[model samples]
Target: MNTQPATRPAFQDRHILVTGAASGIGAAVARQLLAQGARVSAVDLDETGLQRLHAQAPHRAASSRLEDASGHLWTARLDVRDSAQVEQVVAKAQAALGPLDGLASVAGILEMGEVVDLDDAQWQHCFDVNATGVFHVCRAVARRLRERRAGAIVTVSSNAAATPRAGMAAYAASKAAVTQFSRCLGLELAPYGIRVNIVSPGSTDTAMQQAMWAQGSSRAAVIQGDPSRWRLGIPLDKIATPEEIAAAVLFLLSDQASHITLHDLRVDGGATLDQG
Candidate 1:
């Protein structure tokens, strides 16, 4: 492994696992890593989406379940909500791609509801995937990285975690929980030289965000203040692209962020304001 910075591409020969990778930000992260010469294990609950990603990524693995000739891409269907499954897949990925250099915990579900109307199933499921699911992936990856004593982790979060939102109690609370959880994990792993950070994105152009628009909301509604709900507009006057968020995640995972940990990088186009 030629780790000499100038001799190889950034992430060359590195094994990185990205969850929720079948679409949106996770997919972007996986694709970029493959282009950078990394062996990427992309996992998600969307099997069909995984198939599409396996076929569309830069290295485009010849085998859906295995690495390509360059050993640069692998895809799997993962239900991060299942702890046992999360553990199994993490181990399987490491076995197939060698020790993992880091993790991109992007698996999450979006929930939208007013507190009065929210039900147990919605709230529970929201927390289950958004918060506990992140815990399962991070803990599993952290255990392995702890042994190696070197790695980086970037957990995808959202601006809702820091800022308040109308009709988003469950979603906001769940994200906030994971944000603090990552910070705690970062503190505990610091002694082992493992860096853990969070990427909190605002409104991004993705299927999930598009879903909101599909329900009679317009992109302009997202960019302009929805004062009725108290949702602020994006100061940048544009929605972020998945690639933009992935760029932030990669920066935190790369050596460029070697000295940064327990940090939360916001990619929300200033929707939450700098105070968030």
Candidate 2:
């Protein structure tokens, strides 16, 4: 693990709400923020994953944790698709951790069926989880931050949003919706001192990717392309690690990016650029 030493505790005493913090990209972002001295309120649908994260303190110094926690981490089980549940969780998280200084919307779902082959329910579920879930979480968080007049938001999208994939129409459309949503939100939030942005990752070696690939034919065949140009369809020779994607999220949320917003930062190892 190549951990970067903190340049400064830019998020010290600040609170961040991380959706899908149970695992993968979300979990990695939470760990990075916690390590940088931020007090985080991690939320996810997986209660067991949250508990495990809480049990394992990501920080070295006990004092780095939010006091009164008894060495435990702040967490909540949230289903982002439920609007009411999202609102309730956001309210509780804010009260527990103080004002939310930032958010990383990483919770999303993926599907791999062609347009005609995908059922309406399947398409809706993809959009509901990946697109609507973002709206709910971002709106809930933004409402509070707007009152405070300061915050930053980074959303995880995908390279497929802009580049076509054979059997990923639903997933790609949902991600594309996410990209546009974030851009619009960025414009709207700027006046309130809030910034919104998107981070679109290329093929990543996460459990979700493996599972989706398993349900299909050969994974290599689905993702492979030319070798001479070193420009495979997935770009990277090996799938990117979750932590690598988290780094891009961290950069967007940091003060170093105060002037940046509405940008689709493609952390795709040049995959997006290769689309023709």
Candidate 3:
């Protein structure tokens, strides 16, 4: 006789942390989380971007009048590559915003070049942000979540992690490392009632993707397979908006995915030819 609504906002009152919250997918994720009534701690190295994001949240105007006053949103400047800083910022966020209910690790950098052409700095920078940075955030947050025995973590990787792409050696390799690391972390955290998952996106319509386009026609070229580079065209015939990827990230972090962990959900529009 209890026929309640089958669905409702899944993130109400939850405190979630999102990295790379300045622009692209990270910004989109923060915005969506705020709209869903979640308390969001938006973290990024770009303090300006973080400020803009905080100002743009839907409840910003009403927050000043609310008595609880802690506001559902906060911003922090964090460089995930530094383990000490990661730990410090995460701890600070918990202190200010309360215990974290979820984490979305979207901070990453893309360095393009053939392996032979890549220098030590370029290679290390790629792993530093894309792989090692993820490790720092995950490790810091996982310890606390493990003790609490609850929470979810989602890492945004790339389709290139699975499909080989010319001129993307370092980026691909680093993503691959995070992909496996997330799976292993998931396995370890499963017993503690925590979930860890990966979202692999392809050719999303963000500034980072636009920068890769050298010519006006580059967008079309991306839609049409480039045999010379061994890249396949998107079967969906369109680049995903940042919000599309954010939706998947939110789902994995919600109770709806309670039974899901160690899963890599591809948001790549079949760009990898369904490669597992």
Candidate 4:
């Protein structure tokens, strides 16, 4: 009788880097990757949140005894806004965790206001983190992945990128930028056997979403369309969990999606009415 343990995880022995790992979608992706036996290099600007994530997935630790084992999990404090900092961190993470097999850029921010009322800083900041931040990480990782001749990359965009939303002009535009950028990058990396894709989630049950909710009516408002705001409700009639989004991301990163590339998978519960 063969009693050798079967590898239950698809990501076992693979190295993946996740941005925005402190909270929301990034944190969820990190947790799922760790659970799936991936060597994860979790990066985010929030030091405390990274610590909590590291502690929660102790079993995923590279070494049960060593405090800083890079075998299973590693965490780094990173601000994606700075290109140099992003480059340095990616290098350090790749060095510590091993060559990267996958990269998930989940770091983003939200600032809402009427276009007329929105300040210059707000608009720039939105693009800075949402679009430029993605550019920074993707550029850094793509170089190494290209050299290795293989890898998968998933960028977490938003449904708003496809559909218009009131008071979300900046956020919507930034997401649009990432969506197009990912597709173009996919084209560029195709010859190298590297795949790039996008996952656009809508109204997920994350701190970022909850923060946008009103005291009592917000949840219902999100479920039931608000014609006044030119917003349609989710057809599924519920918010998504971060894990749900993470699942889609993992699928794209895994071999199950080997033939898929430059695809934009929307996880919006038909919220956009499938427009365009």
Most accurate candidate by lDDT: 4
Model 3 residue 30 lDDT? 92
**Which candidate do you rate higher for lDDT, 3 or 4?**
4
User: Which digits, one per residue and each the tens of the lDDT, describe model 3 over residues 148-265?
Assistant: 9999999999988898889999999999999999999999999999999999999998888888885343778988879877788989999899999999999999888989999999
> Which 10-residue window of candidate 4 scores lowest in summed lDDT?
61-70
Q: Please list the residue runs of candidate 3 whose C-alpha ends up more than 4 Å from where it truly belongs after superposition.
A: 1-8, 61-70, 215-217
- Provide the TM-score for each candidate, comma-separated: 0.95, 0.88, 0.93, 0.94
The RMSD (Cα, Å) of candidate 3 is: 3.0
Looking at model 2, residue 2 earns an lDDT score of 62
Question: How well is each residue in 1-276 modelled by candidate 2, as lDDT tens digits?
Answer: 969884667677778899999889998988888888888888888887776667665643343332224122478888899999999888877677677889999998877777889999999999999999999999999999899999899999998888877678899999999999999999999999999989999877777888866885445743575354333555554567899999999999998998999988888767667452
lDDT of each: 0.89, 0.82, 0.89, 0.90
Spell out the clash pairs found in candidate 3. Answer: none
- TM-score: the better of candidates 2 and 4: 4
**Residue range 1-276, candidate 1, lDDT tens digits:** 976667677899899999999899999998888888888998998988887778776755356653332347777778888999999988888877789999999988888878999999999999999999999999999999999999999999899999998878899899999999999999999999999999999999999999878877878999997888878899999999999999999999999999999999999888988676
Q: Report model 1's TM-score to 2 decimal places.
A: 0.95
Model 2's TM-score against the true structure: 0.88
lDDT of 4: 0.90
- Residue 265 CA displacement from its true place in model 2, Å: 0.3
Q: On a 0 to 1 TM-score scale, where does candidate 3 land against the true structure? A: 0.93
* N/CA/C clash count, model 1: 0
